[model samples]
Target: MNAILTVLEIVAPVFLVGGVGFAWVKAGFEYRIQFVTRLAMTLAVPCLIFTALMKTEADLATLGTLAVAGSLGYFVIGLAAWVILRLAGLDMRTYLAPFIFGNTGNLGIPLCFFAFGQVGLEAAVVMLAVSAIWSFTIGIWMVAGKGSGGKILKEPMIAATLLGALFLWQGWETPRFLTNTLDLIGQMAIPLMLITLGVAVARLTPGRITTALWLSVVKLAICTAVGWAVGTAFGLTGAIFGVLVLELATPVAVTAYLLAEKYEADSNAVAGYVMVSTLTCVIGLPLILGFLL
Candidate 1:
């Protein structure tokens, strides 16, 4: 029962902040989702990643292990999802990326912070960096029929991760004033992302929602299992293990719908995945957290 309450404490703020965005959109507020997302991703999120990496006292070896475990988890999930989709006769372009890449950034980061504090955030950031690198490169290729290797070079988060990793390795710190300013900027990332997520979901037009529902269930099970198994194999315990599973099991990203739309795939269908999977997680994530706790 204490575990249940702890799960609630961790997840309540996440959902509440997201609910605020949903309500804002429903109330006919001007959200400017694209602008907020851009700010969060290009500026706020990068700063957050940089600062988190720079300041975290997590052992370098542990961070490295989490990074490796995260990469393996994604690879296994991709292979498994590919097989499932092909057998189910679904459109690979539309379904594969969503299955392979969960919302490790917008949702995963804050949830980890709430659940496990700074240590969780440190581990979660590593997972996010792994997911982002792959999503921008390999995940894009699956959707667009061409790899976006260029995007890897262009993304600020990628740069931040590399620079942060360098600092972590070298035990360097930015000037105090600069660190404080960046920290302030980074503080906007979580709330901005949560609110933007609500705005984006509110704006989506779902298609084949029933199909999406089943797919969401299956995806959740697969991801939870795979993340658990991989973390166990790596001998990960406590917060790191929980984080690996939680980050891998986040709902389908709103960005997947946007990507489908941008690439002229089945945008409405992808919207269903985004909508139902996210909504399903309202219950699903908590249960997972309950178990982890």
Candidate 2:
């Protein structure tokens, strides 16, 4: 009744906006994905993270605890993903990274914000920061078999996280005018990211459909189980705990496919992962939201 309507309110916008991009591509409309992605990641998302952190009412200690638990969730899931890959006799390089990381940025952040309001978003951003740091460093290394950890420092996501933390720690506020400007920019991030997600999926040519399908299921299960375990163990509750499970259980990131293409691993397989995992979210996210609510 009321719960069903509540879930719909939270989930509908994400799908509809993403669906618009999906429909747009199907109708042969132009969407320069690279440019849009660059804008969102470089400018818009950073602003969102900065403002979210700077303005958050959550206790700093709780946020820090959530951050640690989120990292452990990733570590535990990475180990589980590795074991699954080995048992399935899959390629380590092509599959490992995607298994560990999910679309915490594009999908998780918006979903959390919708589900739990400002507090949910505050917790969600912390998880996003943790995911970005790992994906930029070890996740990249997993694909390329080389270290580019330094690149993590240069990422705007990281810069915003650090700066916002500084502001939060010092209990400082930017002038109202600048704060409003940043908030305006931040507002663009979630919708832009949702649309970009759809565009990326529409554009992908996924191979290994069967493999991707089962693997997506595995990914969802492992992340959910591990996230639950970590959150409970850390004594996280309410918005923070819910965000932990949801973010970790998000679909495989589109960036994983891009990284495979760049590193010459197996782009088509990774693309399959991205598409199938995202599709699962159509059902999986709702159920998770139902349970959490």
TM-score of decoy 2: 0.99
lDDT of each: 0.93, 0.93
Clashing pairs in 2: none
Stretches of candidate 2 exceeding 4 Å from the true structure: none
Clashes of 1: 0
lDDT for predicted candidate 1 compared with the true structure: 0.93
What does candidate 2's lDDT look like per residue over 1-293, in tens digits? 99889899999998899998999999999999999999999999999999999998888999999999999999999989899999999999999999999999889999999999999988888999999988888998999998788898899988999999999999999999999999999999999999999999999999999999999988998899899999999999998999999999999999999999999999999999999999998989888899899
- In model 1, the clashing pairs are none
Which residue window of length 10 is worst by lDDT in model 1?
31-40
* Candidate 1, residue 247: lDDT: 97
Question: TM-score for all predictions?
Answer: 0.98, 0.99
Query: Per-residue lDDT tens digits of candidate 1, residues 1-293?
Result: 78888889999999999988999999999988878888898999999999999999988889899999999999999999999999999999999999989999888999999999989988888999999989989999999999988878888988999999999999999999999999999999999988888888888899999889999999999999999999999999999999999999999999899899999999999999999999988899999998898
